[model samples]
Target: MPTLKINDVEVKVEPGTLLLDACAQAGFPVPSYCYHPTLTPVATCRMCVVEIKGQPKLATSCTTLAADGQEVFTESPAVKDGRAGVMEFLLINHPLDCPICDQAGECKLQDYSYQYGQDDSRMVEPKRRYRYEDLGAKIVIDKNRCIHCTRCVRFTKEISGTYELTVANRGSNLEVTTYAGRSMDENPLAGNVVDLCPVGALTSRDFRFNKRVWYLKPVPTINRHSPMANPMWADVDKNRVWRFRPRPQGTQVSTHYMFDEERLAWHRYDLDPAVRVATPVLRGAPASVEAVAAALREGATAVVGQGTFGCDSAQRLGDLASAPELRYGSGDRVVQIQFPALQLSSDGVLNRRGFSERGYRFGHLDELLAKVKGGEVRSVILLHDEAFSSRAEAAKLREIVEAAPFSLVLEPIPGELSGLATATLPVTTFLEEADFVIDHEGVLKRYQKALQAPKGVKTVAAWAKELAAATQAAHA
Candidate 1:
């Protein structure tokens, strides 16, 4: 460790750490545009300029390493002036399209401008313009807003290992683009570039023009799309999920960015207002939750709890079965992701590890089916989400649940099996519940409420606990 003074506050940092990172670790946030942790630092963006004791020129703090006895001034007048000058350069060609751009509220450029930029610009020439171009189905590139930081280019080279994006031409004509006739749709990690861009240069087509960034309330959540249960930002507004962004833990190692599929999974929960199940139903007719729970308690002799649910939901679903051993595990959607030390999961059901920890057995659906056929298990209760299960697995699940004499399906959103179920209890989606998920590695990542469950719907665990108490009272 080497001791360095940042803005006069002395701090020790591990060797080889970037000066900007060391400053950030010491509670001094260095403004940076080209310095993503996962990308190679080209020091193209001069946003992180800092004054050193002996250097005549302000060096880029992001690529600079601190040495013993180094005195760095992160907020000196000289450093401030340099940063302001860099901000001016960045805005020279940037289109003032914040009103229409998706990254307005969350854009680093927008924040840094107010903090370190001038209110008026000196540019008298006609502002540069470039038409918005689709890089692929997943990403849209706005060349005019780009600051030529090369963060996207570095990302494709260093993180994705694709090296697809490159700076073509020189100076004002330099543009980040994929090879001729190539599309980013082939890159599973393409969505990450959009996140890497500090400005509105890169935008997600799925998220663009849908919602303003400020209107979204961020909830720290885990990605259900990965086996590792990667931490993520669940941005919601007015009880609807608007987008998902990577919220990397300091050392969790799931990349500084999330895969495209994980980013897009937010769309699946787009509550279809017309199709959204509003109330608990008993054999397709509207019914009270109490009535549905009571009917479920009487009918279900076994349960297959989907592992896509949170730990709390798993516990309650396990309790719904006739016995603990009768509780089976579900959800077998596997996604094959091969990235460099990131996106660590093939199994899409992130909470499966948590559910299994609670005594639910996987690959044992046959045991439940045999029990149901032998008349030992007459009824079944299911907590399910069709998206987390593959078509083949869903077919198998439908077979097992339907095999029971009385099938009670609990779904947040109405599904195909809702019609087959003798009783259907509407349950809350993951966003509606305030719970935590333990990843495969036993990391208990807690997430807050992003959206409110529709009227007449409650969390899986709440419904189960209430039913269990009611059943016990009836028995007593």
Candidate 2:
């Protein structure tokens, strides 16, 4: 370990740790634009320049390694002057479009300018301008707002390995663009460039001009679209989710980025309130949850739980079955992608490990179907999300539901399976429920409720507890 002083505060760090990181660890975060931990550090943006006591000139902290007993000053007069100069040069050709820029509230340039830049620009020359260019259906690039950080270009080349983006031209005319006429639409991880951009240059077409970032409150959540169940933020406003952003775990490269499919999955949670199941139903007619639970208690019961849900919910749903062996798991829809570095697993079920740990057996739905056909199980409760199930798995579940003497389906949204059940109950979507899942790597990740569920819509655990109470009361 190397001991160093940042702003006169002594700190020790591992060998090879950048001064930028050492400063941050010492509670003095050096402003940096092109220094993402997962990406190779390029000292293009000189915002993190700091004064070292022994060095002749202020050094870029991002590229300078910490040394034992070294004295570094992050807030020194010389460091401040360097940062101000860098800020001035960066803003020279940048457009003053913060009012309409999507990255307004969270932009690094906006933050650094406020902290280190001069109030007025010295350059009276006209700022460079170019019309926004669509980088396929996913991304839009505005050249004027770019600071030439090359974060986006580096992300494509080093992380995605697509090599579609490059720095075109030199000096005053330099801009990030695709090769020749190639579009970034083919890249599964294209949307990540928007997150990597320190300025308003790269933007997501799906989220562009939709909502201001200041109004969106970020809620910590996990992406269910991938088996990795990657951590993310669900930016919600007025009880609706606006977008999903990658919430990278510290120093974990695997969690630093997410696929475009997972980023766009926020739309699935922004379902129409009118189309959601608001109350429990009995025989196709609206009824109380207690009524449905009482009806479900009359015969030998089994449960079919999809592994895409939380562990607590899965455990409670599993308890509704007559015996330990009666609980079965579903959801085997795996998505195959070209990148193994990005895609951790082909298993689409995010919480299969959680459900399995709770004693729910996978690939045994057919056995449950056999039991239902043979009269061993008379009542069945299915906890499911249609999005995670395939057509064939759904069809097989439908067969089991139709064959059972009594069936209850718990779903967040109304679907065909709900229509076939003897009783149906409204359940909270993942966005409206707080639960934890053991991901494919056997790491436990928790997601919190981002949006409010419709009135009378409860989580699976809540409904199962109520149902179990109702069943007990009927038996009593």
On the 0 to 100 scale, the lDDT of residue 49 in model 2 is 92
Give the local distance difference test score of model 2: 0.89
Model 2: pairs clashing at backbone N, Cα or C within 3 Å? none
Best by TM-score: 2
Cα lDDT tens digits for candidate 2, 1-476? 89888888899999999999899899999998888998888899888899999889989888999999999998989988899999999999887789999999999998989999999989998878876666888888888888888888889888889899998888777888779868899998999999999898889899999999999999999988878898899999999999999898889776889888888988888988877768888997889878887777777899999999999999899889989998899998888866777787899999999999988999998899888999899999999888889999999999998999899998876688988999988889899999999998899999998989989889999999999998888779
- Clash count for each candidate, listed in order shown: 0, 0
Task: List all candidate RMSDs to the true structure.
Answer: 2.0, 1.3
lDDT (0-100) at residue 213 of candidate 2?
A: 96
Candidate 1's displacement at residue 408, Å, is 0.9
lDDT of 1 by residue, 191-261 (tens): 88888888988888888798888888998877777677777889988778988888976755573678887
